[model samples]
Target: MNATTPEDRPFGTVLVANRGEIALRVVRTCREMGIRTVVVHSTADRDSAAVLAADEAVQIGPAAPKRSYLYPPAIVEVALRTGAEAVHPGYGFLAEDPDFAEICARNGLVFVGPRPEVMARLGDKAAARRLMAETGLPVPQGSARPLTDARDLAAVAREIGLPLIIKAVAGGGGRGMSVVWQADQLLPAFRATRAAAGAVFADDRVYAERFLPGARHIEVQVLADDHGNIIHLGARDCSVQRRYQKLIEESPAPALAPGVLGRLTGAAVAGARSVGYSGAGTFEFVVDGDDVAFIEVNCRIQVEHPVTEMVTGVDLVREQLQVAAGRPLSLGQDDVRPRGVAVECRVNVEDADRDFLPCPGVLTEFVPPGGPFVRVDTHGYPGWRVPAEYDSLVAKVIAWAPDRRQALARMDRALAEFRVSGPGVRTTRDLLREVLADPDFRAAEHTTSLLAELTARRSRPHRAG
Candidate 1:
């Protein structure tokens, strides 16, 4: 199956089937791993910073992802042409696609993620929930099947109670999801969610679940190998979010009770073991006070992976390469002890007050922060025109400190130093400043819905000095 045996075939050159900051992140690690990298780019991304960072770059197709990044055979061809032995899909766009992984395997190219079977098993949320529940993991009380037309409205309503979430079976990153507050809104919510899901994922299947109000969006970054060895890098507090997408994240979630930490870690391991989960993946959960319930599992590296890496000195992308090469995880559970606190803020190009709308344009004024405790991961410059075709995340600034308060102060200072500007671009930086300065957030007394309420309250916009 694998070229040569698991231990023999070397993980040589890697083809990064992604763009932007993640591609650059992987390329940097590949440089450290002494492995060459093949960077694939769409026409719109021909001048992307990641292309310059790679050992070799390839123009795959037009600007559309379906023609470039999502086209498996074309991407594989690029890998073959460039002598790339493996492929690393960073987060979105074919990262969790099972058929793509299988295709890479058949072509004798390593896919830097879990096996195709694992992805297929966990791709569907309802199915994954059932499997995890079978292993005694705590999953939300939800329907097993994607709603069958919402025909039995009353019965379904009685089953899931009020204030339930209507989610797409194949949803991720909050795209194909809707929340229902009352019985009257259920059918309309389901219709809208189904339409959105069909448009986004080609899956019109919708499911219902009891929404856990005030649950913290906590997750564990897990590393595993082919031989079934697994370990957890401490949890991240991603409670600061809007519409299920995290805005800021920090390691060693504050305010968790004594026994709650172990339970969260154990449940994550159990979920990983359930689908024979391997490679670097994240298991997201909604922690209701001290009680944790499984939300979903991301089978690829996440946007907030840096916080965990900063706190625990593990090069996740490098480890991902090693794990894909069929190498056993070099570090055991004890080796993953957390040392310091790390916080990451995602700087998105969006107008925060105008319904958080995307603000894409040329970077007229771009300046990133720097200090001993700060690290900025980005691929944009002053002349770079922010592409409207992709996600609005421009860059990430991470701060590390020996303790939470120091990390908080370092991040606050870094945010103040950081600056970005363009015509009519409304950013979340000022919004983040307000949220970070909040007493509840400073105390870590927040949840996934924190931003929703924060935005609902009047925000006095403060321009960067």
Candidate 2:
């Protein structure tokens, strides 16, 4: 790998090709880096914070995501028309889309992520599992390739045993996944997952894997440069989740056996290097006891990035910009140091009691919490209507402290003080508070099934002695 000179500045102007908090998150970093920003929005996001904060804003299309954010050609055209030197697909819309990255490259704009080929390789779940296993990362027992035929799927399921998971090849963000516990449910689950995957990701290919029940969802954050320098920023615990969607994330995953985290981070760096990856990415793993298995790789900035940032004090977006500009990583492994503990909660506009149903409407009043180490990343403001067309995520509240106990306390307090009220607007704030107060969570003994168990216990009727 060759290193570029320090005089080589990153893109002068970047177009954020997503909406909501993530788009605004990118714009904020660009502003601090002295780079001009252009944010493209749909009719629903015309008054979004990202659109308002950007140096320029473009109205791409109507409220429908397909007509706006997910449309690669229109986004590329906007970048060209606005003279944007690069395009930042913040996270969801086209973040993991290799074709979108290729389109940006063909148009001579940096895509602010891994190369298109690398993304295509790692974006597919089956291919990624194969590559990681070859790179010496432990993978769960399952089919080595995608299971497209019904007979093949059943055979693999029989081999892997019952209670396995069927996942989409192009799945991410917990979307295109199903768990099969009985033999009778195998074929139906596979066909359903395949159909949903095709409808969502345009790729119906499906794969099966041995599901690790009660495992901790741990992920290592890695940063690499064009110069072949790869380093892990440490690990994050995202075990508190419902329906496979993470609600809370914390850094320096608690209560791990000695050297477990070290091995996880080391393997993550090795896997990233194996693929010649460059940019900010995450290597997710499923950990049960001391054993860990590589799950999948997210080849873009993640939603839980703020918790890692809070502990490492590294601006991942800035690192991404520098690496995208063909520059070497500013800091090496020896220079990287992590301090303190941090926790982040995804404050979504949903009713947790009602099975997490989306409750979107105009925000009548919005007041985010603030303090010494509390950081709130949000795009909502009074009178801003939450669009039901997209994700329910409205804000990410993060808190940092010297220890996990203090961090949890700070997070609880921050959530308590957060004031968001509107017509038909509901948040997961109360449920998050309850999770933080759980004894298992406080002791870091929780697993990926914690949320489900918690909800089940709450709903169970008490019997009279």
Candidate 3:
């Protein structure tokens, strides 16, 4: 069967159900394509860049995410009232909410992502692990079903061995995860993990998995249209993270073990096709000792997508719009080629010196870096107040070059040139610079635990810089 063109299935108006940089990114693409955008914002974001740049802006609710972004009813109502043909949930909030996607469908609006069922299957961490295992992909030794009781949880923990990890079955980003290094820590970790999971995802279901220490966090960028055309751009190294939340990402993952990179990317494309996925998605994995284990799937565009875009020269947002419009992909598998190296550092309003504590305040001076091969994506201005209610991310600084060394050098210069500050408002600029200069990071030998281990060492009196 042939796929329809954009003209045959047009979504002229899209309601952006997100905030901050991602919303602005979507609006920018919509403007380029001559598609109107309706930005729904909370009271705190009335003056946000996205709201100001949008074709139309609507005050959805208060600053609390539950009332504004996460509130599906308000978002769906806004789309219908504004006559929006589709809703684009960028990255976080309701991006992977299966019920929210279903509501969009019921309201005669395109969800601008995979089907609700697909989201349900891929968004659930446990379910995704099972699906990947079923597809003959490598998944860590873990429980495929939710633990029913404390005894059941302990049994699974014992089965997976002592140094296993407890994770929330419903969500990720280390929101509800704990490392149990011994038998004594199992129950407490399980309880804490469940409590955290319930608080974040409204589900207390927890599972256990073999924890691989010093692993590299890598993921493949996948694009699949409704026409069954699936292609992988490449892999990204997201190993530099704090608390499992990615802080830096680079495309063409540096120093991948022999055959490991090809296998991971191939399995990612195959996984997407087997699940009948659509639009942009990411297949996340943890590489340990020449083995890659499937972790979870991000059902929407990722925060670090700019790295892939810089390297591939593909407008992922544009491809997503076309896919949602029922059009065939503009490029085939052979056309998806990556060139150059790209690195992205997430700039957040945190005091890295004070252990990365969140320090939000009005920005007194905000000067982003520029020049060749440098891109800064932000929703902040000189006097904009950095709100304390949301994620700490203030901007994303990206740099590209012909090779990884040059890319890193460019990113270092860009970070150095960039300036953002306010009263009691601390940023991670210095920390990123320090990391960039570290020999291990420069050599691509840094793993996910490197940052945490560095932080621990930094606290020691003898190792204080």
Candidate 4:
């Protein structure tokens, strides 16, 4: 890899890794920038919107992610075979995998993310926590290192105490974690968490931390160029979640303290700079009543990133491209500020009344929301087959407004406008409606477990048809 400056990235063919909405999102921007794109996919995503939109398409493997998207060597081989100059990993799968990034560089392909070393540094939440703590960031209080055994974990948790979070060293997207409320459950929790971590990431190095109950999830979006210029695109409030997975997110948290934004943003930028970070990344924080602590930083773009883009009018995907091309971030921090409130609800192919069970099939009919202040990022359409083998996410419906209430109203209206159905498919539209109408959400007094609470309170013995 050449050490060219940010403004010198190659403007040739780019291959897209991963699939679905994010893939289409990258491809559209590449076309707008006059860069040709090639789409690589597993058999399951062969009929996905991304494959149809790209200039060319290539089949890398079978339907499963492990066989296709996660196989770096095969992806690199496809890139080499297709003559693409760079590979755009649109989050998930290998987007944050440093090994894949290194492979891309070794194979003469621009990885389109931060340097591999930086990724390795930030990908491990525990290591990043210690680094940020050293860098003057307000990180959480937890095991400084990954506990080696149940006794070691118990000893550390005894230090941190009960009602703490047991986190995997290398974890993301709410996976590889467990919450223990009692000291007696430590051993069982540790064993289960270790099994989960090992099964998912092949890493069972786990740690413990004081869990912040009722904490709101806050994150800052930062973009940096190779020329040493880094700027934040404000924050997102992802407090509405279920099973530790986010369902609804909005920009400019409505309940944040007067000066909290500056603090989180500063820490986010400071943490990014600590690793000499480049490309687009998000610094996540768990917020208590008025206290904040750095949780983890996502090394790539997020699912709700479109909400920030909608309100701020910053094309994160485009900036990612330019940064990969060795181009300085076109806009500074001041220029990327939010103009209005934007809220995003993930439209998943799941039955709302059925424990959010996956409901994948061919889309018999589909129509996304559209209007002023409304943005729909999707990779599904009429006649598209919704694969059950991957994520349940089908689209992100976002709405922007000048104020929080207006944004909520607009989001409700947008949800009403959404029309998605299949021969035997169910969506979370009704559940989202319940969430939007919840008094706690409307009053801006909720946390990460709010949705699950609401769901459990209303969970019926059987699914409502």
Best model number under lDDT = 2
Candidate 2 residue lDDT tens string, 243-271: 78999999989999888998899999999
TM-score: model 3 vs. ground truth: 0.97
Runs in model 1 with CA error above 4 Å?
1-10, 152-154, 459-465
TM-score, cand. 1 = 0.95
Q: By lDDT, rank the candidates, best first.
A: 2, 3, 4, 1
lDDT of 1 at 371: 87
In model 3, what is the error at residue 311, expressed in angstroms?
Answer: 0.5
lDDT of 4: 0.88
Against the true structure, what is each candidate's TM-score?
A: 0.95, 0.97, 0.97, 0.95
Model 4: CA > 4 A from native? 1-10, 460-465
In candidate 1, where is summed lDDT lowest over 10 consecutive residues? 1-10
The global C-alpha lDDT for each of the candidates, from Candidate 1 onward, is: 0.87, 0.92, 0.91, 0.88
Local accuracy of candidate 4 as per-residue lDDT tens digits, 303-419: 989888887888888899888888888998767657879999999999866888999999988999888888898998999999888989998999999999999999999999999
Candidate 3: misplaced stretches above 4 Å? 1-9, 462-465
Clashing pairs in model 3?
A: none
Clashing pairs in 1: 350-426, 351-426
lDDT of 2: 0.92
| lDDT tens digits by residue: candidate 3, 1-465 | 324445643577999999999999999988878788999999999999999999999999999999999999999888999999999999889999999999999989999899999999987888889998999889998887888777887788767776888888888655788888988887888889899999999999988889888889999999999887999999999998887888889999999989998899999998998899999999999998698999999999999999999999999999998899898888997997899999999999997767789999999999999999999999989999988889999999999999999999999999999999899999988888888988999999999988888778667777557
